[model samples]
Target: MQSPAAPATPATPATPATPAGNAGGIDPIVALPARALSQEIHARRLSSREVMTAYLDHIARVNPAVNAIVALRERDELLKEADACDAALAQGRPAGWLHGMPQAPKDLAATRGIRTTLGSPIFRDNVPAADAIVVGRARAAGAVLIGKTNTPEFGLGSHTFNPVYGATRNPYDTSRSAGGSSGGAAAALATRMLPVADGSDFGGSLRNPAGFCNVYGMRPSAGRVPYGPGPELFLPQLGCEGPMARTVADLALLLATQSGADPRAPQALPGDPELAALTPASVEAALAADLKGKRVAWLGDWNGYLPMEAGILALCEDALKAFPAFGVDVEAITPPFSPERLWQIWLTHRHFLVGHNLLPHYRNPTRRALLKPEAIWEIEGALKLSATDLHAASVERSAWYQALLGVFARFDYIAVPTAQVFPFDVNETWPKQIAGRAMDTYHRWMEVVCPWTLSGCPVISLPVGFGAQGLPMGMQLIGRPRGDLAVLRLARAYEQERDWVGQHPPRALL
Candidate 1:
């Protein structure tokens, strides 16, 4: 583990940002964690123009290799915005922690005026008139909307690629993938193209990419971050927007800004009053939670019911040691509920939500022809679901929720593998097989994250370490429902112990 990168001035055009190794060449400002970077900007130790100029220069140099950030805004306009933030700050009116920071929302997040293509040629010229709720929050907080991150078409797959912007390659190895629909977000954060990013997760969109990239990402409890003010928020609970950053403290602070209640999102969870108490200055202390006597259930591979690539679980088990070292009890436990049943419940809900949402697109013959097979599959499967099937699946989902509550009664957290396989070839679509077993669906390879997804629990992907091939992997520290902050605290504790901070940068970039 490496010590957290210290804050430094923005790199000059001549300064080499990525050199031979993880430690030496990273630009000082690019190396700083988002929280620390925020402090530098807010305190005026670094002017917004300085901060923005450095990032623009960094992105110009770094983003092309990975293709993580797309549709970059005009450089001059962004610097002008940064100057405005500086002006407001000089007037004692700092917008917030993100003032002057460059952030690229995932392509799925609609940005007003700026192109918001969902990685599809069908909407390549499409630009929303208004910002998506998540994008709006970041803009309001003073983040410079530098550009949009690339994502899969319709944000449909765990891998981030689309016909429009190509694929967002893994920064650790450009030959491999960056997982998605939030893959661009994770990749950008890993390479320091963006200080913090917003992403969405229905399946493993958030966790898988974070794991593959060796960064921190969270799929907050359903409604914890109000994914919408969306057209169909009332129906979808499986997917939600989340925060991703290089460090836990950065992740938590970004989560604080993105979370809160909105009248439009009726099912959104109430904001945590405890979260209100968190400031960038005190985030480290807030996250340094004492884990003495806390109990964790390590449900690896779901008792071998789910297949995994070689060395994946071993890496996870090794990381789990951080818990016991904190005086938290780590027990390997298998749930009494059938893993297959839970998977079915997950598939049913996922198909229903995805299908219904894309029905309008599917209905048009010309548009349907433009749809990817995965999107077509989801809608077709959804069409087969009768109200009775929907009702039965809903009942099973409820049963699993109750079943999960029983497990939570005994343990404060459950740890699981964030991804079953490591980063695969960037050009390949999805993993068709794992450990010699065929994946029946495009997403079955990601089933490890499904059970937790079904529970709608707050799950954070903790950067455990790298695999034999040098690809990074993460462990899912899943908290009880609505236990968003608890999960962060535990993730922070594990991160602190691993000391896996400053040193372990993307070697490919370095």
Candidate 2:
């Protein structure tokens, strides 16, 4: 495996942690949640090397079962880097909050000197000269980049599989999928192989995987986290990079690290001036938040417009009962925009963006052969679109945004199932049908997540618990546009009120 280049300037590490203390009885550092782990490292309770070694050992023992992490750096190299962190800590230099943590970014993200295959064989040996914005921010925050997490080919699907690293199996059910683009990251977080992970979302790449793996993943508002230090900065802003974690607090901390504007990304959203006071204990809004009498609209199956599998919607509905218990009023209300319009808007944007994004490779006969069928489909569909089609879709998209704004005027949050179906068989490429409704497109089964994507709002996927078949599912809590912190706080409150967030999956228990 290729080792990423060291940081241009070394970050001063925090005060040295005692490597031998297990006073809390959590001797194995891998067992700690990211928030607790971060605090322990900076408070001198655990050394960077100790955390790195524990993680390495755990990864060796567990990663083979699910194949969540790939292109891992050799053990000696990582330990040596951890040692450097410890040495710098002794010198009394304080690093960023993520000082001693280990992170494996999604495969779609480029890492300096490390292979970033994008789940395609074409880039199997491609080593990048620089990191993507997500990876660079994490590095600047003092995280040790261990390697890349798995994703579908070019991150085109929601199931993590590519010729490069193969499919990532669900940690809870090895025969089932872990969900994708961010699938591998979710699996890694669920199994305790990574303290936290990062991923991107276009059509629920971040949400689906987290739900399938029974972890937390958020798709922050578009531009909130800046998509790139790459070309194509403009147009196709449907997807944005965001954080994934075992808990909401860790998600907030990561969001803070990943947020903030960059001149390189001209369309990026500005950082919150009030974010300086953020803490893991309370991932709240600037003003104090109150749940009393807050209105939440549940768009369950879009009022039967969406064909969800039998058990998925029930799980989401049951999860909503907790909100009302907290003085929140939950209502089953249909959005003013029909499901078909939302699907059309989502499809149009995908065709335009994905077509332009992948046309270069498709134009090359050899490269085109390596592209996935879905990639080809997106490109061809895009070619069939005209400037008129895009204009009409863009116009409709603005109306859809207004429709959502109207919903927000009456509701505090919008709710939906994160996925139409639970984790399917690992060998199957995608669900061909949901609740007997034939899926017309490769991503049709995921239409449930597209509304939030099209709206460019902040949505968090929370575990709704396992289905009758024992496979896990997730519920989406959609907050207002650019309301990243509000949705995060709601998820934080849900994590505390409900008992689902910390329940370990099968692998974590073992």
Candidate 3:
């Protein structure tokens, strides 16, 4: 791979002035969110064409080294989109929430007329005739689709490399990873290849990569964002499409634009509370309210399936202490279910879904060769699951839910480390030996993320602060089921108090 150009020098915490390199020329717009950029365009400070050209130019310059963007649309098409936005502005029309913003979609999500490779050689030239639900929503909100980002094959792993697109390197340290299958999205946002990007999370796909890239990511409550065009769409309710951005407000804006009830997903509505109104101020107010008398629990490590890296636990514990500052009584608590059993259930369910859904492709040796072994393992595990096994897992899952209910009855929220370790090397797969124990499966190393997945609770991964490595470490704020606003409110409060927003990857120096 070619070496990436050195990033520009680090700027101060305040939004840096548009670079002097951009003088009368469209230099790449780095680190700004879609909403903010759109506001600038509405104010006539920048033209949509200039923003598009800046991002397109940046992609051309850096995408070769990072391999983040898998496809770039014709400049004409992007220009057309820009012209539409400009015409709207000319008519004195108010722009939509994301009007005139250029964004990239994770390659796994279908994009109309654009190659959506799913990071596999099998679909190297595949293009969907229709947009995925989220993509359609983004477009309707007036987001200009600049390109598709990279992902692992079938989004089966946490690392983004595949036969179709090469590995996406971390912008912070080229030698480290940008985390996957949203690695490409994270890298692009970190390097300012695009103002903001979209990502989907099955198991930390959004949160993990955001933590790795030092951006903000939220995994909304399942059914909060509709995902579809599949027979068993509701089966894997744990997964959902989510937004990734450089600031808490940007993420909230994207969520507002994309979230709502779909007839296809009857349960995905935003409830009585308005999600769009969530801001750092509201979150701080909620954090300040009733914490003095509220109960809080912290899970330092989950049943030892994966060992906590030395500083990770300390970092999380320190963040948890802030709950007390908000007036909540805090204590370390353990859930009722076994971590191993949770992993087994996740593997069985995920494998079964992938195996049956993708049977035709797996039957072909050529296609199967491109499938990740972990994906194959999931399929095999699913095939072996009996009705009894599934029912038993469901029972255990219910018991785990009950355990959470018990905890919530005593405490308002549960806090845990988002990942056992900070960002690892970009070239390696997940750590094989987490705490000296041989991790038997890809899901084992990510045990903490799954417990909340099974419980179907709304969780937000908030950047607590940088770890000893100078890489960001996040704390998972698991709120009551359907407590999306409350969780986001808490995240906002933490973000305000700590002011960790706008922290950029060192590579942005280039």
RMSD of candidates 1 onward, in order = 6.1, 9.6, 6.9
Better of 2 and 3 by lDDT: 2
39-123: candidate 2 lDDT, tens digit per residue? 7887778889999999998888889999999999999999988888777777776477778789999989999988999999999
Best by TM-score: 1
Q: How do all models score by TM-score?
A: 0.95, 0.93, 0.88
Ranking by lDDT: 1, 2, 3
Per-residue lDDT tens digits of candidate 3, residues 395-487? Answer: 877877887788888778787877876677877777776666777777566767878877777777776666555676677888998787677
Task: Give lDDT: candidate 1, residue 48.
Answer: 87
**Residue 421, candidate 1: alpha-carbon lDDT:** 93
Which scores higher on lDDT, 1 or 3? Answer: 1
The CA lDDT of each predicted structure is 0.85, 0.83, 0.72
Candidate 1 C-alpha lDDT tens digits along 1-510 = 221111143211111123433435767887788898989888889998988887888888888889999999999999899889999999999888888888999999889899988887889999899988888999988898989998999999799999899999998889999998899999999888888999999998899999888888999988888876678768888889999998889999999988988887888888898885677899998888778988888888877788998777777777776667887878888765898898888878988999999999899998888899999999999999999998999999889889889989998998888999999999889999999999999999999889888888999998777766778888898899899999999888888787444557785455
Report how far off residue 183 is in candidate 3 (Å). 1.4
- Model 3 TM: 0.88
Clashing residue pairs in candidate 1 (N, C-alpha, C atoms within 3 angstroms): 1-499, 19-510, 158-180, 180-183
Ranking of predictions according to TM-score: 1, 2, 3
